[model samples]
Target: MACVGESNGLTFWVAEQKDYEDVMSISVNIYGGNDYLPHRYSDWMTEPDRVVILGRKDSKLVALESGFVVDEGRTLLVEGLRVCASERGRGVAGEIQRFADQYMQQLYPTLRTKRQTMSDYHSSESTKSLAKFTELGRRAILSFTGDGKSFNGFISHLKNKLNSTTGLDKAVSVQQMVPLEDAHHLKNILLDPELPKRVQLPGGVIIQDWQPFQPIKGNLEILARRNLTWLVNKLEKPNFLSFYTPPYPIAFDGGSLRFNIDMFGTDLDSAKRAFVSHFEKVMEKGLLTGKIMIHVFLDQSLWKEMKEFCAGETGLKLWREYWEQVIMERDVRGGAEGKRESNM
Candidate 1:
């Protein structure tokens, strides 16, 4: 009983158990261009009671969406929704969403169901998605990553930086309520004496550390070290590190580093000042190098604070305009800087 939909030359159909493996393979082939999805699903499907939706055609599968029931059996946990590149933008995703909503309602009438998606931690998407996902259940989690040259290498570099600065040997630890993947890699990094002290949340929820270098003089040294470590670690762990290409394929042109700060950590004004100060230092020294540009990524809360900060302080306002101009010009260049922030 496969439900089907068609557009243009392609068709979409509800996949059967026989179509699962092939559909998975197709999905892996397309989405596997980045490690995030594969890594997430690899961890997720290990659990019992997980349901995955697959799209297929003539016994060949093409796309998948997966989720599980969460909240002591009162809610559905939709990890993500993904479509095959070839089958995308043709209403296949809408069909999948419709099917999923109806299917879950029928299967668990008493349970509230919800879908989740990852968004840039510093962007409006992150905050909005968090709200939407929460409305669907008790607590939906949002995840973020440190700016890195590559994923695996970034973890390693972060580990090294933390080890040197904080004397923290645990490379990976997160506070509870943070929905983060890569806990295994974080734990592994922490186990190494050479890695930074990784802190874990009480219940094994979220994991992270502040920028590793401390004391003003050590800033460049720390940045250089972290970048070098990223390169070295990539060569060492080819499989884990190979998945990401330099976001920019060309040589040092200019780049942006964006990160989200935990607003709950401290006074908003103080945090904004500290971040701006650090960014200025990094820029003045050409640490990013090659006519580098910096763009601060922020959520609505932080964005509002930043806008206020820029308006109130003359120097900060100048810097803000400077970077904004650079970003606009680069947008005209069609360079990597022009690309939208990665969704994960």
Candidate 2:
């Protein structure tokens, strides 16, 4: 085993294939028992231009952090940051973060920034920590709960509401989903170089299932690997777009499945149609069971309307209150630590 760094009784090691069990042991009740680390840990081990650093004390796992090189190697996207429950107050998170930053600097000397998404970002020290970071963009997150049995009801309710809207603007002209594997069409839309600044995207950042990535070729290629279902209202210069990531088992509500649907655009009608189409597609997959936690990330303007529609129509409970997933970045220089170099 290669030890990367050791200091003050804590040792940092590059995560190996055999350390999965030990990592799982330290992660308890993370993300309210729906932690994504457990499901994606193995995949992170094999992903290119990524590194998972394990922090240990006396040869025992105490923390885990991962950095994915994105934005064409100029930025390091931090994810799966966790500290052992027993070691929380000992500055474990800060240490692991510093370790990952230094290691990445050494590995990728051209690195200019360290980026992170703020969801679990809200800790007791959220306000103070946030003050040091620059906000890139954020999307409103609304979480709902239902299952395969209630999926059809949810769609029906959405359609019924769409049908009865007296306000002509409530009418959704398009409810049909694009072909799942329309390779040529998807490439055409995504190939647009200006996807970053498009008004459809929040703050010009394309966030897939809580992971914020710049809409560039390298990042787009990274998103392509995930078995995501891409849907848009049109094939050319589309006004509506959404991404549906496959459901995976969670440790909440008797092993419920969690599905993430990221909708981009402010049109209420198109957003409503997106739910119908995405839900139907998920139904066809037949992967859902018992309780399904659906987290919808969309424009803030559509949050209240969509929430009211879903709650009043389908009667699904909220997995959590309304939250915003903001992407924050801090500038990095040669051999930087977790310290704030400058507010970017």
Candidate 3:
């Protein structure tokens, strides 16, 4: 006999291990892709988690919800929720969320005191879904990035503005060039105790700098794990840093830093708008610093798309033009000379 319950316009059942293959099929179908199943299954098996399947007696599967324990503490992360294609608009996904929350509260009463973290909501692709999920009382934490070009323009403008006031032209310079793909190498170096002395900044503060200058080449999984450790340790606050590769690769050195956007799915306008909005928010928060390197990964397609998007849209074009003017003006106003002197 199938155990049944009704909460959000759907029937729920406790999915068993025997149901794994079937539920996995439903997930792949709901997502319209099979690539994520192995990872999904791995999470299910290893993580203290729950999988609630939604369906009608006549249907195989209408929706699926999964949550995992995280932080080795009280928080439970909603790993993923997907409604079958044919059943999407029926509010099945929302119901699944409600049930998941209630079920967790009942099962782990301690979780009520600890915050719930929805992992994987930072990407632009995941933005809409994440927003919807957050409406159910989840907090959304966004991650932002600026490719090399955007970073360079922003830094140039900032440097000019600072120099105009302080009369100090050069604030910082790159000490070593590291390939973006070699972020792992940087991670290893940072972890090592015997590396050369860390770079000293203008205020007598010493910090290590990792400049990712090229596209990463190895397995993304390994890279993500390495980068996550670096991010948690290095990025203690929101600050701009260069890491080559536009639409930062999904994997960081730490497992995958899950975000909501499908980087490949975004159109040029959307991409530009997303980046600009994130940048403005970051700037408004006053986190800009000249020491930050904006890493940009410019693959052929992304570059072409960005170029076309900039050319076609007046707002984007203006934004680009304004930044360019800022850079040029800054360069004219002692930036170039400062660089020359630094070379000496």
lDDT (C-alpha) at residue 83 in model 1:
69
Q: Model 1, 249-326: lDDT tens per residue?
A: 111212233222221121333334334333333334434322222233322334554444433211222222211100
lDDT for model 1, please: 0.35
Q: TM-scores, in order shown?
A: 0.37, 0.91, 0.38
Candidate 2 lDDT, 1-344, residue by residue in tens: 87989867899999988999999899878887778887888899999999999999998899999999998999998988888898887878877887788889999988998888877337335666566578877788889887678777767776667767734344554347564367667776776765544536765677888787767676767888988898877666777778899998877776888888998888777788788778777887786657888899998899999888787645478778778788888887743443334333
Q: Name the candidate, 1 or 2, with the larger TM-score value.
A: 2
Q: Which portions of model 1 miss their true places by more than 4 Å?
A: 1-35, 118-344
Q: Which stretches of candidate 2 lie above 4 Å from their native place?
A: 120-124, 166-174, 177-180, 313-315, 334-344
Cα lDDT for residue 258, candidate 2: 87
| Model 2 whole-model lDDT (C-alpha atoms) | 0.79
Lowest-lDDT window of 10 residues in candidate 2? 335-344
> How does model 3 fare in lDDT?
0.36
Location of the lowest summed lDDT over 10 successive residues in candidate 1: 322-331
